[model samples]
Target chain A: MKVYRLRIAVQAISFIILIYGGLFYIDMGNRMPTFSCAYVDDRGGGCFLIGFQHMLSRPFGEFLGDAGIRLLKAMGIFALWSIVLNKAWCGWICPFGFLQDMLSKIRSFFDVDLSRFGWITRTRYKSVKYIFLVLLILIPLGIANSFFGLEKIPRDWSVPFCQICPARVILPVFNGDFSQIHIDFSSNTTMVLTTIVMVLVALFFTTAFVKRRFFCSYCPMLALLSLFDKIGLLSLKKNGQRCTRCGNCSRACPMEIREIEEEKVLTNLVTQDCTLCLRCVEVCPEDKALETRFCGIPIFTASQQGFLKRQGLDEESHTNKNGA
Target chain B: MIKTVISCFMALFCLFPALATAKAAQPATFMWLEPMSWDAIRAQRAKKKAAITKVTGGQQEAPNPAESYSTSQDKGKKRAARGARPRSYYLHSGEFPQPDRQQSGRPARMNGQYNHRAKPKKSQTQAILWVKYPDNRSLSFAPKQRGPVSLFSFPAGDGGWYDLFAYHDQGVNNDSRIHRYSYTHFMSHGDSVDKHETNGIEGPGFFKGQPILEIKRLCADDHECYRTHAGQNLRVQVSFKGEPLANQTLTLITEQGWKQSKRTDDHGKVSFLLIKELFPEKIDRRKSENYLLTTEHVLPATGVLNGQPFHHEHHIATLPLQVFPPKSDWQSKRMAYMVGSGTFLLAGGAIAIRRKRQRKAL
Candidate 1:
């Protein structure tokens, strides 16, 4: 539970860093030669996006150009983060997710759809994010391609989220240069639309509002992160026999990972997006039925064996040890 | 020769200051002009021909491959024709510069004519002008939008490769005379290898390809002319407006005395602080013979951009005064006479030596 608190604090800090990325954008994208903050002051001040993008395209060929190279570098950075931190970007730092979480908390809105839909809508639509990522990438290339067979210019590899991303489409329109809206017409339209849509969506699919805990249940990003979860550093274990199903863990689950009922204790194999956002362990009133750890190798209250035995569940940490 | 030289010198002297100060009060951006598809242009011509056919009322027949009005046509048919057709000559079909993109409503062809410094074959026909702006100031090349658009206006090309925009003044007048040295001052953004032509993260050369920007006097066709009459220290200045760049150290030296250096002043103006002092060539000849007088600036451009400031090397034309003492002023103009006489004799002696060598070969 203490770890949960710490994770929240860290998440907030990481959120600040993400905002720094934004400030850096407004900080440096304003100048030209496109992506190079190469000509900066002694402090080397500029956007992380621009500076980092410049670094990537360099090792490759010149066709990418310096600006194009920089953008490619930004992509490499994102991919690296996906491998290292898994889906943590979505959990703690995604500005879109941040907005979603804020909306999910409104106590006033309510809606019950008369139109019924199947659960299959779950896994299918989760694939949309990848499609969105692709769309964002291709649009710019397509435009360049039309002008002078500009097919040679590299695509926007970094911020793959920019393409058809509802987040950007819904918010203030920040230009490629990263300058903020003072009188940006696009920003005004997007702001009004996002606000109106947020209000409407909150009134309708209210459950869709939860944080890293909610839409992430089927988030393609989570699907990707889960693959890396095998080597992840955060996990949770439940003590069944000690589990007086007080409904506490279920109430506390941040990502809404199922916490109760089945006599068998199931460790979330897909915890890459877990972000160790430990709301589950904090609410467990059975004097600790659920516990958190690094890779399910206990670091908190007890070992995995003791908890499984108490639950009368027969599972071994063998596979976790195998790491395959 | 003397008359032509003096005329040229006088022209340089008169026009140099005029160019520096002659910018349009409200300058316009350069927009890309490109032609449409061959099919589209052909279709348009066909439509015009049809119009002419109708106006002629079945009189003169229109040619299929297309032809000039000067070629023999049906005169009696023309009399039968009710309306007269203004003469139209179809240009010979040949390769012309085109933009890569499909027609964006703008027709483009490289207008190297105004570019009096570009090489020959450049002005033969039109191609995409590729109006490349080194910075926003170069934005004049684009059509005036309400303001600057986020879009980059470039030529639409074919194949996999794309063409870049640059306007080189093709050197020659309709008379085929060498282009007048345009003392018409305008900033010349020095060319550098493209980013792709360079390495990433890895900085420029180390003892390999020379690092300095050799000051080149753009020839009639952008040829790099070296060693000249105006002295080697070709007073090169890097400036924004009229203000000189003084802070940065810019060195001009031959490989021999590469040690001497000069820095720009507070006004951002740097003068010739070179190791070798330049001596201008002195020459004299008959009044009407044209002379190929020239000059050189062996400069190397280098310096860290302390901030995000921008700069350019503007080769302001110095007065090409040959100091020809008119026949009226003799005694008082002794220095002019002596220098002019010495130059004429030296030139003659050099010519004589070459002739003697040629005679020996025969």
Candidate 2:
């Protein structure tokens, strides 16, 4: 079976389980690495970021005792989940990513061409996710403790990222809950955070038409998952000895990661932006040039025959036609 | 003409206090439990500490008024002296004074007073029946007396609603009437247990077949309950011996002394649309105020208790609820929709214009 078809099936099943699983008593726990939003009333699981932010919003002195241990335990669980699937959590499991993929499918059905970021723009935006990850951590800490003689941040800033996350507003709508869409006018901090979410939701809708997986580019989860890239169990390996560098893999990549095609020496092709969607391995025309390995065992390998069959240009059929 | 109207409004405002005072002067016909305010508790603790210090310094301490006041009239006088506030049953989850923090600057004393070794005095007026969650195990105890108020440290085991039933039975009155004052409080600790479990195995019959009359707030579901808000319809049912008592008079009294009375239907349920009684300042928008729902049921059947014959039984059940400020005070859904749609249109328009310009350039 084609990798893209299999990925779609998995994404559909995952989306259903994460979105409507609560109705069937399926609880995947609250520490899921994906964007299974807790704000969704019937969600089977919850994103870990909300709990993480809340745990971090305590005084530094408190962390010296049970608080620090609790933080580590939660982080350990998150790390275990992230390391197992790696960035597959982003491309294959995230409900938000599935929504984007569905929107991209709609865009494709309408024949709307996908846009690409220029080299300079892509390089500049690479740090955006890292900056968001930093702010999500520092803001919660600042809420509980004073920094450099500055007064403590107000409590309204608790769960700072979840307040601005588009999923908090959008996912709840699937369960017929529109309560989160409102702007809280109670305090200035809430007013600003909720307004920012409104704007992001707007961008999330518009950007999907022109670009595939647009929001994935700036997701803080990607920044966090990238830290486990070296130790992840599942990985993409590239053989440098391949004769051809036709750049087909780069063109087929959804995240537009060029490093997969350009790097000849790095056997590990799971770049920071790579979602492990394995589109590159599927499109690679060279035999055994690219492969997806689980614990160093090849699960899927690039082959000329498989590539031609996927492209509907099997050489055996072509030869038979010529002979006829 | 405008000045005359303004003066009329000013005159009415001046008469408001007199009207309130007149209403407060009316004698309370029913007995209800009231939790001591945090300020009152602190003052009582300070007074106790001062008395202990006087004893340690070899000075004679004055006779305590709380200990001396035993009659109902003396209790009324004490309440009037503090302030003419009615005794309304309420469950407070607010912050309590930390004894260690308060006495941190003082020198350490080995006397049992003001120390952890000191035993908590039990209350003679009120007793609490604590019903735990999930398993619904119940334990009855007389709440520890702290000053004029009783305190019970709820052992929040697994963080669900722990129901507390506070009752004081005034034995056979002069008219051979049994007066029972009962109050139910549902206190939640943390977010561990499922709220749906609150409706299971625990309801109006949670008193375990005891012939106790109680008023229970009827919720459509547990998710809609736990805490109530203003503008919400709060339905309460008055039950006696696990059966509904129809036509009972239930009165809802707000913290500001506003009272509304309603009679139960055939189903023994009365619904009250909790109105916003307190228009709090901007900073106090999240503050929740107490509203007491008191129901009185009279049984005509005779009863004998402790060899004393009672012609009838008078049961008064009071349930205090914390009503939050209405959602409309802080949330504007219409404004949110407008802003959200406006942003979507502006973003879509900008993206379309940019695509058109790029196509033209190409």
lDDT of 2 by residue, B233-273 (tens): 99888888778888888888776557899999998888999
Query: TM-score of each candidate?
Result: 0.37, 0.76
Question: Which consecutive 10 residues in model 2 chain A have the weakest lDDT in total?
Answer: A61-70
lDDT of 1 by residue, B1-362 (tens): 99999999999999988877654222211112122323545586679778878999758655422222222233432232122211111111111111121222333333332333333231332211122122211111222222211122221111122212212121232222111111111122111113234221111211122111111123331111211222223344443223444554543322111223555557544434222212212222111111111121222333323232223222211111111212221112333234334544554455457657867999
Q: Residue B293 in candidate 2 has what lDDT? A: 80
Model 1: how far residue B176 lies from native, Å: 19
**Candidate 2, residues A1-324: lDDT per residue as tens digits?**
898999999999998899999989998877788999988878888898987898788777657544576678779989999999988898899999989999899999999878888878999999998898999999999997899999988878888899999999998898888889888888998888888998899889888777988898998888889999889999988898993889999888889998888898899877878888888999998999998888888899999889989988978886688799
TM-score of chain A of each: 0.49, 0.96
Instruction: Report the C-alpha displacement of residue B330, candidate 1, in angstroms.
Output: 73
lDDT of 1 by residue, A231-262 (tens): 54555566677766556554455554442434
Which candidate ranks first by lDDT, i.e. highest? 2
Docking class of 2: acceptable
